[model samples]
Target: MHTRTRVVAFQPPVCRIVWAPRFAVKSASNKNSRRASQHEVKAATLTNLSSDRTERRSFVDCASEDTLHHPSQLPDDRQILQGCESVRAPLNVAVLLSGGVDSSFALHLLNRAGHNVQAFYLQIWFQEDFRNYWDSCPWEEDLSYCQQVCKDADVELHVVPLTDEYWDRVVAHSIAEIKAGRTPNPDILCNSRVKFGAFYEYLASHQDHNFDRIASGHYARIIRGDDPDEPVRLALAPDAVKDQTYFLAHLTQPQLSRVMFPLGSLNKAEVRALAKAAGLPNQARRDSQGICFLGKVKFSEFVEQHLGVWPGCIIEEETEEVLGYHQGFWFHTVGQRRGVPLNGGPWYVTQKDVHTNTVYVSRNYYSVDKERNLFTCESVNWITRPPDSASQVLCKVRHGPVLYKCDVSFTNGDQSAVAVRLECNDQGLASGQYAVFYQDEICLGSGVIQTTGVSHAEIGSFVDDQTKAVL
Candidate 1:
């Protein structure tokens, strides 16, 4: 006899489930439109697992009879289950939803695998003082989508307000780094600090609710040894282009221990196909870009708003000539070509003098003679333990599929600092940028780039003091 698998709305505890009378769900006919009319939905009650008290949550049963796939047509559980090698059966999972197709699909997979899943939408967008940012972060629309997804899966959804935590942990650090003339990746901090950091802390305080593991839509894999004491190592996803292990490099062993990435084995195309086949509401939705907190707000605007403006000079590195002027030195980073106004030709930012408030540019930014591969990383965070000196490893200077084969050595017996020498040249190395380390497919950890070996002396002849002063 053959058993059949089907998409379902799992039944929860005896606690009541109600759809808030005021909560409006988008109608099926106007699904794609932002201003879609509200569909008539009955009220149901779902116990709020995020809070200490028994708070009543209105759950709208938005599961569409027409949209759901037939039992035989649903995606095979094996595709997702293959990644959960260490997962025990019937786990109480807390899933992080971003109102996107990926997270929604992960939730569906978990439900199909016989796990009890609860969804949480984190509110970390700018508010109050920064309310003017992008009219607003389009969070209401995102929340609506989250509610609909939860309703369809028959899972309880909770909205956790974490704006303060986000600003304190991620944004503050980013702003400070910018002011100090260093580049910082807030997304990395967001994953380590807010999504996984603050959210974990929030859940820990709620004694009444105890979740076995946290699941997310991140395209990264985790490999666990059979021994309970063995370290849980982070691995790369099959989707090279969409792999997010770089952002997750800062995560600790404890964080990795309680986390689950269900989309690890699938690529972007496969995810889209599975989502479409599953008839998910956001199956056709485009992937989000840039920093999450910024939303529709531009990065430049955010920088200007917080750091204000301080005019500075843009000097050519070879000639030390004043080619143009910029609003501020903090606004520009090393290797940045865009936004630099120079009439002659293409110029890349080579260096910056924070004291002089000057940005140095160069036309020969990628000159072959200039050795830009060597750099030192400070404040290194090892996922498991520090690697032995001269460990041959692969490192990512930034987020992308590209990984440079390199060697790392500890600095003067300092475990928190490592000197890295990449096998190839990278033009964009700058202070405060993270260099995530890896071995084969397992992610080792990450560190902030402190200094580089990039030198402009051999690139071209320098202008004399007389010529420089005249310009």
Candidate 2:
């Protein structure tokens, strides 16, 4: 653990004058129309507030006392600052600090922007009853780093414990999906249901604090188009590999209206540099992986603890011969190559039977005949507006930089469900995974996968025939 320290820096009364960190900053040519501006206006007054006292350059003019809007108008969540319609004033932002480098750096940016920034650390770690399942909990250390960052930045910090909410919204949903033989993305649910959903509810109930926007270190951008009638659009980050729009696709318009992403323009390397330059305690800290609420516990251990183990046979799909046994069918998923107890060359888990409690494997998992390029998704959430069938789209079945060009059509003449056909065959098409849709850099939205287009009827009948022959 790194030692945490807080250094009180200078703050201006009317507007904070702080040095803009060395990174890409773009200006908005036409403030009224978002289409005219490719990037958000990020230029700020460059003044080093440290003891050395650097030179000041006024790139972004601060709002004078005469121009300052009334304090009462600052808390309106629906009030968006459009050209000539509203005055430019500092925002009251509630930043979600994860104690990671990206989020800590995002706090730095918000503080420099002269917003009334307050930090909140959500504690979703599994403790108490599930304490034994976790080898080590990192939320304590995360909170410590968050405290140090907020202290140095001279901002108030709040620790929001949402364990029960997390369980009800994300963890339980994940458990249910896994038990029913589907891959569930808890991070996606956490963003929509827990972080933005439950947190907003918590803020609303508490009248003492009123925030105009909820900021996070997410690598996504919000584009408010020229027409105020148009919904806010969630765009991809400059860093494609680190873009998190997929996880945030399910968030409602109201949630997105109040969302701010300061690290949207900064790439991973630029973020790291800014953190190191700001003297953050966790500048050198590695990024956290796996499920957000799991802490140090592996996903397999979580499933085993909740669902327990039911011993089942792992049979070869090509042959009805049983090759090995598995602890449970829920533990394995489609296209998983590792953790299977098999020795005859490499084997991939192709299917699982929940009722029979059987796992199916195949040596040639990528055969052309078995390729999956078609699927249907239900519960579709369109971020901006629903696109017509002729619209060009790209789809992501899972997280990462990989995206497949796809075609989409509304099922049964309505938008109740969507059928997606990928241009290329995918090997890991699993039910219950989210199919996030995008058009160019703009994230359209996402949906719950209802069908994987993989059938096991032939295999099931063949296994029964072999069993009868043996008997």
Candidate 3:
């Protein structure tokens, strides 16, 4: 005799199940063996079905169709899905589209992942004269690309004119820093003040549109801290070579909590691959270089336009010889080599005396000193909680992958300001430049370089007698 049995299958909320019926063969002598074989076959069938469900789940959670076509080539769906549930949810999100490969890919990924995404391009450059000076000003082209991408993704694109805000907050601050003989990274201020600050405020205030979070294509990660008391932390991107964490060190806890970086785990190569796979038009487009707001104009040209050139003398540090002259001390920064009219060989601006209107130069650009290794920073903004006092931490004086070992000690009994002592020699430390602090891969916070310490001997040797007399 033969008995028929029905197998009912079910899956999670994401998928549906199917039912099938099969007949079981029975015999008197071989009944037990036959039954055992039937049971084994049934168990194997269920196992296979479970695997199919897993593959589908991987597709959904990973949010990349490339995984389905070439699973081995992409990262494990589990790894990509980690800490991404909030992003995968079908909530209203505002994406900052820069008409670049990264931002376009971000918009596509969020849309595919079932999120309600809207695209925004902040028009920060309003100067029409930029076209006259800069040959590569791609603002018009960039906006066109943004529009096409948004249209393809069926997302509405909004062009917000932030020119006034950008000039007021970021551009003004950078010009001020340059005039005061400090190196300022305007991108940092743009991210903190405009993108996450002003843009976010605009979106949140709208009664008609309720966005839960803002997303960008920046190559950095924001994750919940291990300690409950600590706020969310900003971390380095998985692709160290393309990490943008330094520019985001000034972001506050609230800003970080409300923002998402879709390209956090992806390298540049992976981003390009995904863009190509998704048919993004800007897949092969070149990445933007230099300052974001400056467009095609050179930094020196832009500075010179606003802050007119004031002619000054350049003195060699060692012999106090008049090596050459500079248009303005504000136009040159410490460790700058070019634009100094010198003939013998390469010369670097070692120091600037604003009082005497003199620039100091040295042949040994890589000169190491105790003063260069130590400096003080103010207006420190911590990403998470402040680290223990006098703790050993890593510091990045610029927006590169290089990290210098340093010890941080609070100054004037103020936690917001600190003195950093680098363990190794590093040149080009400028006032107004940010000293981004870190503990391993986590971005701790950042501060403005208020002043740098130089040995009296080093200063006196380089500065002219007239400048030293004033000092």
lDDT of 2 by residue, 118-161 (tens): 89999887763665645476777888899998889899999998
Spell out the clash pairs found in candidate 3.
182-431, 317-462
**Candidate number with greatest lDDT:** 1
State the displacement of the C-alpha of residue 397, model 3, in Å, after optimal TM-score superposition.
0.6
Q: Spell out the clash pairs found in candidate 1.
A: 16-45, 17-44, 17-45, 17-46, 18-44, 18-45, 18-59, 19-43, 19-44
Task: Sort all candidates by TM-score, best to worst.
Answer: 1, 3, 2
- The candidate with the higher TM-score, 2 or 3, is 3
Ten consecutive residues with minimal summed lDDT in candidate 1? 13-22
Instruction: Report lDDT (Cα) of residue 137, candidate 1.
Output: 68
Clashes of each: 9, 0, 2
Residue 158 CA error for candidate 3 (Å)?
Answer: 1.1
TM-scores for all predictions: 0.79, 0.77, 0.77
Would you list the clashing residue pairs of candidate 2? none
Off by over 4 Å in 2: 1-88, 128-135, 226-229, 389-391, 454-471
- Leading candidate by TM-score: 1
Better candidate number, 1 or 2, judged by lDDT: 1
